[model samples]
Target: MLYWLMKYVLLGPVLRLLWPTRVTGTENIPENGGAIIASNHLAVADSFFMPLHVRRMVTFPAKQEYFTEKGVKGRLKKWFFSGLGQIPIDRSGGSAAQAALDTAIRVLRDGHLLGIYPEGTRSPDGRLYKGKTGVARVALEADVPVVPVAMIGTDKVNPIGSKMWWPRRLEIRFGAPLDFSRYDGLVGDRFVERSIADEIMYSLMELSGQEYVDIYAARAKELAAADAAGVRPAVPAQPSAPVAGDAARVPESKAS
Candidate 1:
């Protein structure tokens, strides 16, 4: 009841008027039954927008912090997110990853659409980074079709560090479902898991048109912090002059 109330009475109407979203390829999503909607995380608004576009309720695993706030604001936040079908995930320590995967498997087993960001977190620079293997584990274990979804221009509408939203057009594209039947019954292997994750990320890169980075989110964050603290050396510059003919290609001998 609360979900419908918020979907229709609160967020739905407001979002329709405020941002005026356009969704393409929603038919790519199966009309009914269990499936995983794996997407690139560009903005926090993604959690809201994807659910708004889908016909059936799509549940996502939200970080536990969103539910564990203190005082009135915290209470309101928890109530709101809970009503929206978000499962609170304790994303701290080594066990958090396993917990989230376990929860996702449960959701899928219940025969529902599970929405997950393969990247694991919102991209700080709007570039699609390597996806965590958790997504692959859930899909393989659940044996559900994974649909690749791309949300364009949403990052601009609600960019990072911005408290307010900007009025802008948003596009949500859903690619055809990815089937992993070939791997069914295969013995669990880390290399196989990594390969499956890479395949999914490649499909997302094609759909999102964002530059792909090979680093995981946690490592990328560490690098970003180090650069901010001026501990990392500057990147080297490229040659200024042309090295070969009118085409300006470097000579084979000189390149070596």
Candidate 2:
């Protein structure tokens, strides 16, 4: 009731006027069934904007910090996020990933739409990183289709470190649902899980047009920091540089 009330009464009008989002391929989402809406994480606004365009109430696994504030401000924050159907997740360390996956699977088994960002966190530089295999695990375990969603222009509305929001046009593009029935019986194997996750990331790459990094989010952060510091140590030049005479004497290999 709270979700619908807020959607229809409060947020609906404001979002309609302010953002005025355009969503394509919304029909690609299953009307009433268990499905995972996997999207690229660009900015915080991605969460609110994506849900506004969808007909169904999409529940996302929000960090537990959103629900664990103190005093009146805390209470209000919890209420607002909760009203949006976000499940508070305790993302501390080690076991946190497994716990989140468990909760997500439960949501799917109950025949609900679960919204997850495969990139794990918001893209600091707006480049898409490699997706964690947890998404593939949930889809394979729950036996559902993973809808690849690409959100464009949201970073401009509310960027990573901005306190105020600007008026920017947002576009939500929902790609066709990806099926993993071919790997039905191979869910537990780590190799298979990684392969499926790569496939999903590939689809998202085409949708979002962000640079693809083979590493996960944590390592990406480290690399980004190093790059920012200008501490990239240059490698020594190769000692096997060919002379002009050697280049002319070299034989060419046969083309395949």
Candidate 3:
């Protein structure tokens, strides 16, 4: 009821009139059954614009803080986001990551479109960053297709720290669905997981035409913070293991 009111009666109509949105390749999104909507993170508005145009209800795993705020303004935000079909989960890492994965799995099992930003955070410089393998793990565990989406010009719609969205044209492009059937039953393999994630990122890179950076967005932000703090950040000697949300799945399998 709230979803319908927001989409048809309220915010959706207002957004359509305000922002000129262009969408393409929507046919790539399956009309039914479970699928992952894996997209590049841009502005926070990316979440709003994607679901507004799509016919299916797209649900995202949002940080709990969005729903847990205090005061009247916070209450309004909570209500608005809940109506937007977002579920709150802890994103602080470790067990919280596992819990988030569990929630996403539940959403998929219920035959809903699960929207995730494999890059974890928005790009600091509008370039595509390395995707976390958690998306791969989710798809594998849920046994669903991964649909890559590209949202262009969203960063300009609502810039990094802006409270209000300025009118702008945004593009939402959906690429072909990614099939990982050949690697079916190999969910616990870290190498295979990274390969799948890389393939998805490659597709998104092509769709968005953004320069690709091999580092995670989180790491880049950390480095940027360190630089501003006038402290040198230590670079890891080797790429850390892909500790995605459900890495325990790896231990359940016998090492080959």
Per-residue lDDT of model 2, residues 26-60, tens digit only: 99999998999999898888888888888999999
Worst 10 residues of 2 by lDDT: 237-246
Q: How does residue 66 of candidate 3 score in lDDT?
A: 94
Provide the TM-score for each candidate, comma-separated. 0.88, 0.87, 0.89
Ranking according to lDDT, highest score first: 3, 2, 1
Residue lDDT tens for model 1, 88-168: 998885888788888999999888999999888888777777778788788889989999999898899889889788989
lDDT of 3 by residue, 10-64 (tens): 9999999999899999999999988999999988998899999889999998989
Of candidates 3 and 1, the better by TM-score: 3
How accurate locally, in lDDT, is each candidate? 0.80, 0.80, 0.86
Which segments of model 1 are wrong by more than 4 Å? 233-256
Itemize residue pairs with steric clashes in candidate 2: none
